[model samples]
Target: MALPPVLELVAPHDARPPQEHPCATGVLPIRRISVSIVSLVLLALAAGFGGGLLGAWMRATPPAAESTPPAAVEDTQTRIRAAVDRVLPNIVLIVAETATGQSLGSGVVVSQSGNIATAAHVIRGATRIEVVLANGDRRPARLVGEDSPFSDVAVLAVAPQGLRQVAFGASAALRPGDIVLAIGADRGLYGAGGAATMGIISATDRILPRSGVNLEDLLQIDAAINSGDSGGALVNLSGEFVGMITSVIRDEGSERSAVVGVGFAQSSDSLRPVVAELIRAGRYPRPRIGIERPDEQHVEITADVANQRRLPVPNGALIVAPAPNSPAVRAGIVAGDIVLGVNGAKVDFDFPMVNLLKRLPRGSRVDLAVLRGGRTLTVSMTAEDQ
Candidate 1:
């Protein structure tokens, strides 16, 4: 039998048929072989490039440092040191000897002509006064003028020639949180090489009440102020004097207790005009109303007395008595009348009648709102010099 007819092997459907080459028998063309070699090289290159990219993406990066540069820290220290150097020369230690004992304080040179600004209480009732300069030279000082009755400021005269005076900055430009340096003698122990305490202003336009005194519009700060630090300089970062350290608030729990970081300063803006007047005329020209209210109790009586008299409001400046031939008498203000305002501004504990009059010019004509016999009336008066 044909026995499966010699069982011819069949090629699969997907198999490619072999073609005859045009070149010499059994050898491929040179162009086709070159293309095949180039294709293989390209495939190898692509694979190598992909593997290298993947490896680079999986690698970890180094972290950055968080330390500050040493040079920047040093620059800040240099600036603060420069500011202290510029103002240290103007500070002075004041010593006043009275009949009872000696008092110590601090002061700042305000003029090249030997004018100095200090606290009035420092030189009060002094038989002799001395000032020690930054170079340890002690000089005799004399009271030029003082405004202790109303303000705690005072001016003194010394014999310093060609002395460096402090550069004053505008206190009106100061705000809460402004950095300040309080420079003063340490309990008058150190010479003019005073100590410095730094702090920020806690409040502005603060009113501090004292027995028989009114400290209005004060600058409150947290600087360390000792007893001798009164009248010391409160300076800005630019080496300009902005305020005068007046007093430190002690803890009221006990008379012997001390409180740290609570002090007050008088604004230099208010001191400038007073110092100028003291230098020129030996006294500050303040307006007076010629009415006396000795204490807070007397001032507070306006409220009670107004209720008894059935007045419009209870809070005002109650007149105890008007001086004979004074401005209050000339304006028809009697003891029974109450001053409600000055120049349309209300009279309160902050802006008391005396404080309002002190702000007016000596020859200013002020309109006062008075409550008399349950009627609010306007009274005009001219301010007089104190």
Candidate 2:
């Protein structure tokens, strides 16, 4: 038994103590368990909050059908067409034949008694005139009278039976940016009638320069005006005639190119006074002032009983040159005398010649105050009509 030497056995407690269960008390294990529970709770709350936010977003947005409404629309074409229908019957296409053929323009029936108004250049030197109605009836027209080359306006007469007269509107009150519509025979051809255009009044009181006459009181607009639109009506949206389309503008040397948005019209004011005179008189008499140009500065002198000082001048127009048998000469006014006054008022070389001439009536006597060399003198003279 001693030979085996006996296997020695260690006690459980004394043997290399069993390796401790290392994971049981370490920080890593407890931390991991706590993290797992927290992650599950966080995910549940996140899901609930996301669902609430999405529901709120959907509730706040408006539906497409509830946001948009039906709109009320208007027919502009119907209104313009109605205006044209009411006005076209009152418009006429004017044709005037000259040696070079015919000039085309437009006119309006201004009177139930057959009077028509148009631009003078349209009917200038016309051998004959023709007027065409909207219904295609053409008739011979007569130029009753014209007020030119002072004003480029003329009056024509058409048969009154079937003519439709347009109602005149007040052009004096028109302001800038007011919408205007114009109608005219855009082309020169007969039965072509008129076309309608729309724009606004751009300016007023424009001065137009032409041969022989200074055209004033012009109505400027931006409507499209063509060659044959002269004398056509520029009407308001209310369908009333506001002005007459009379001219179109183009740049110099550009003949074939039609311009855009520029036109002018003769105002109804200028037409009224002109038309009234035409209806009254067969012609407008040109006004004139009677006077003759003096070759040298002339002085007039006259004698006054009231002159106590020995002044050289009193009264009378003195001529520096002997006007042969003229009123100044016949009035005993000699050369080298100073003209002090006419009709009791003093006159001198510094006085306006126009005013002196204006003050002296033709076939009237003028008293002049004058000074000759050293002697004051007064003279009575009769003015001669020029």
Candidate 3:
């Protein structure tokens, strides 16, 4: 981008080049000088680029990306290395031998019991499935299940072995600028299966509707996600898997359709339900509990809110109202009641009722800890279909 022209001194009588400025102020249209380096400095002619390198560098609003300090960059490298070392063992190359050709991609073990989470399109219409572990050990895998095309997530099952489950990081807490690493096999099930690339989250809650695929609540990242990167782990600096790399944006402007450029991931926060249901029921369901949570505040449990309500807990979903003849109403829950837990899982600002509902199957029973008038009570109800 071009920089705006620098403000120059104008002669009182007529405009002349800055080099001809008469050491006297009488021939000038004055602008505020931030600093006079020296009285002699102003007395000399302002030689444009030849002698004003410092002034050019100090120009306001230069089109420069934010730069990281050397020390901070070194620290980031250290963190990336630690995250990769911890997560690499969980990333595996999935080779789905379809009737047409071999479909290769990456997959992350979601459970210690040998359930793997990968992109549904990666293993679509497979005749035989094979999982190549990080150490190059091959294991026969079976098609466990897949979610809706909108989710693009599939689950595979193999015999239980010594495998690591990725520590899931809360995507609900992710910010746009958070540093992340994309670990996957980019066109190299033989060599690139464990490759890692680092980038920042470009955006969150992105919706992409293109070419018959409609996905929602995606994490758009600036990382390189190539052909085989689908279903790979998107790890945070904390060495936690925060997202699953799903699709790459490659328009006609792409370098031969290679989209290692901009990519999207299904947020782990949004995956808890999809992954859980695919493992249990082989599909995703729109589960509803008929309780409305107030969407007013990002942080619902501020110190001020806690003090004002005189609530016993620091974090919870304050029930605005329960739908009439709904599960919450049937469970005796009402407005002014705070839901503190879901089936023994604490309900905080981070893991609120919304996420809890998504993680539960539609027909599952719910145990909620409700705080009403300073007393905690237990309530139970079956989750009805939405």
**Predicted structure with the largest TM-score when compared to the true one:** 1
TM-score, candidate number 1 = 0.65
Per-model TM values vs. the true structure: 0.65, 0.54, 0.57
> TM-score: which is higher, 1 or 2?
1
Model 3 residue 356 CA deviation in Å: 22
Model 2's number of clashes is: 33
Per-residue alpha-carbon lDDT of model 3 for 1-386, expressed as tens digits?
A: 35579786755676564685554655443432334445447657555444587776677547788788899989978988999999988999999999999998999999998999999889988999999888778899998888643467899999778899989999988998998999996645356348888899999999765322346779999988878889999999988989999988776564455444789999999887788888888766645566633342112454567899776778877766567888888778777778888888986545556566656766898888888887889999887753
- The reply for model 2, stretches above 4 Å from the true place, is 1-79, 188-190, 252-261, 284-386
TM-score of 3: 0.57
Task: List candidate 1 stretches off by more than 4 Å.
Answer: 1-69, 148-150, 190-192, 212-214, 252-260, 290-347, 366-381
Model-by-model lDDT, in order? 0.80, 0.69, 0.79
In candidate 2, how many Å is residue 317 off?
A: 29
Off by over 4 Å in 3: 1-71, 189-193, 252-260, 286-386
Give the total clashing residue pairs for model 3: 0
Ranking by lDDT: 1, 3, 2
- Which candidate achieves the best lDDT against the true structure? 1
C-alpha lDDT (0 to 100) for residue 385 of candidate 3: 57
Tens digits of per-residue lDDT, candidate 2, 13-127, equal: 6568679766775646777779988998998899899989989989998776753333312344556667777777777889899998989888878888888888888898899
